[model samples]
Target: MANTREIKNRIESVQQTRKITNAMYLIASTKLRKARNDLANTRPYFDALRGEIKRVFRTAGDVDSPYFYPPDNNTPLEGTYGCLVITADKGLAGVYNQNVIKEAEKLLAQHPDTKLYVVGEYGRRYFDQHRIPIEHSFLYTAQNPTLDRAREISALLLDGFLTGTLKEIFVVYTDMESSLLSEAKSTRLLPFHRMQFTPPAKEKAVQEPFEFYPSVGAVLNSMIPSYVSGFLYSALLDSFCSEQNARMTAMDAANQNAEELLSALRLQYNRVRQAAITQEITEISAGAAAQRRTFGSEG
Candidate 1:
């Protein structure tokens, strides 16, 4: 049975909270739409690049390239594995950061000697707090994902792989399957095999013979880096979209809960106010009747 003032304050607080959550929801929605549009805008270029790579593989038979790691290449790689973990910069996005961090932990457990490359401040802090060593942290890229950032990341990874400092590279990110569903998953980036780019049997078309300017190997060497950059860019976009969607959902739920709380608080405030008014009226009526009785007796 709190006083009306206390209830009114609570109601105002809930209303303020509701306004913040609603604003967050709208912001997240806008971000999500922009991310989707950006992805859509860049998709055709990547699709063409992928198609070209597939064509090269199909037309150029038995090419020797540094990017292609065949199954039977017995040359053991000398370095440890590298993993790039993608996470959101800030949290509030209901379990989005947690799920990706859990996925990264699983990977680290499996590859104990992995070199960790983190993308977000949240992931960097989490790993640091847990005493897990981070090889590198790409600052300010998680929130503002751009082609330049993706290219920079891919360049570094390619350099490590080329220099034999990292044997294999993998990325852990969240994929937005739909507006309501997102899954944290890992994708291997380096030492790509030809089978991965090969078109399916059903989708295969007749390949026309084409000649490369320098050689097939040289052409592949040039194309592989762009392909890798494109792949990384797509992964970043997916993770961003997933984060936005998760935030939107979380904010929506918060807004609803705030509304419910405000409703209850307002009801309680009305009840308390009515009771106070009734009590005051009762006291006034009783006092007046008593004074009238005194006057009547005096008269």
Candidate 2:
């Protein structure tokens, strides 16, 4: 009976766990859908801005801009580096936070003189627990990534780079390749490299000479800030989407495991119950036989 009671308690616990996990799964699914829509809406704009920047650099001959390259070639080996790490604020997301934190650690290892700017609580906690100093941390931004928030983060990084406080800047986050897949990736956000752009084929319409509002360099200078903000925003969206997807998958798995455990526990409980019933029947029969033997002796 005790064993049966314990099993019953376990069954109840599993059921409650399953309920929580199933609810979490549904919530994550809803968040993932919203994140996906947000990503779809902003991705094209960012892509276009990026492409235009590259095109300008390609066609505009002999352009010089502070945004195009690092301040100097002779950056000291011990120069401080800036790392922006994006992670989920909450846990139970199946390594979504760990991957980004690990990637950030790798960057920190490479550049020991680093100022950390974290975008989530998880990374901040990990770094704090490890005794790593964080220069800045933005909370509640990952859940709802916006252009204004991206610009705010970009401003900090840009100021550090331009002022020679940080020699280079890197952003570490998890990228959502698909609903089922997420991968950690790092992108250098500073010391921009000029991309090699190929001209369109002759079959395409001949492009005309384009004129910038002021000059190509000036236009680039003006656009670089917004471009960086857009890039960061895109990364934030990807990381947010990845987190949701990971949470959904984790909760789904937990629910399934709970169901399996409940099944096994139920079977054990049934067997124990059958054994108890059989023992009771045996005891009753033996008592009746003893009474009948006493009656025969009396006669």
Candidate 3:
């Protein structure tokens, strides 16, 4: 049992911690909403971009480009693979960063010759501490994901792929399925497969032909980079939203735990206080009775 003063101090400490956690919860909520809105605002353009790519594939008829290809079953897997890993700059977001790092590790284990391009400080530090080499780290982009930042990242990756520096590129990030559910996922970014652009069976309909400016390949070359940028932007938004949601959930749980601890501490404080009061009263009564006996003897 702690003394009353110690218990009081403990209660105050917990109260302060609760305040911090509550504030963090509110901040995370705001961030989550903003990220979702950004996603909504940008989704239509990307959706249209994707639709246009599909249309080009449908109308262009077996276009020969470096970007579009089917995987060769006979080709041996050689050359450095590029992995773009997204993680939070700071943690307290439950297992959000852990899940993403784990996913990246899984990718690395399968493809040992990977060149890591990390997006967050957390991921960069983790890989550095583990002695794993990172080819690049995009600092300050995880927390502030913008269109320009996405474009910059995509441009670097596209350059690497086009220059034959990287054979394949993949992005590891978290996808927010709902407010309560988020899952880490890895998606291949390069060597766009024709089947990936194909619409679903239900959505397939008659297509209209589109005339290219100079040639179909030339037009596709221009469009593919922007389309890849859009894809990267969407992934960043998703990962940010998931990180914020995870933080909100973690803070909410901390707040609840703090409340429970405060409740128990208050109850214990009251019990200790009552016991001290009772002991004081007993001591005073005994002293008063002794004084009365002394006076009677004197009389």
Model 2: per-residue lDDT, tens digit, 17-64? 899999999998898898788878888987787778767755664677
Please give, for residues 44-140, the per-residue lDDT of candidate 3 as tens digits. 9989988888777777556777886643432434789999999999999999999999999999999999999999989988999999999999977
What is the alpha-carbon lDDT of model 1 when measured against the actual structure?
Answer: 0.88
How close is every model to the real structure, measured as TM-score? Answer: 0.94, 0.91, 0.95
Candidate 2 minimal-lDDT segment of 10 residues: 197-206
What's the best-to-worst order under lDDT? 3, 1, 2
Off by over 4 Å in 3: 71-77, 200-208
Q: Give the TM-score of candidate 1.
A: 0.94
Model 1: colliding residue pairs: none
Clashes of 2: 0
- Which lDDT tens digits does candidate 1 get at residues 204-279? 6656669898898899899989988988999999999999999999999999899888888888888889999999
Backbone collisions counted per model: 0, 0, 0
Scored by CA lDDT, what does every candidate get? 0.88, 0.83, 0.90
Model 1 spans > 4 angstroms off: 71-79, 203-207
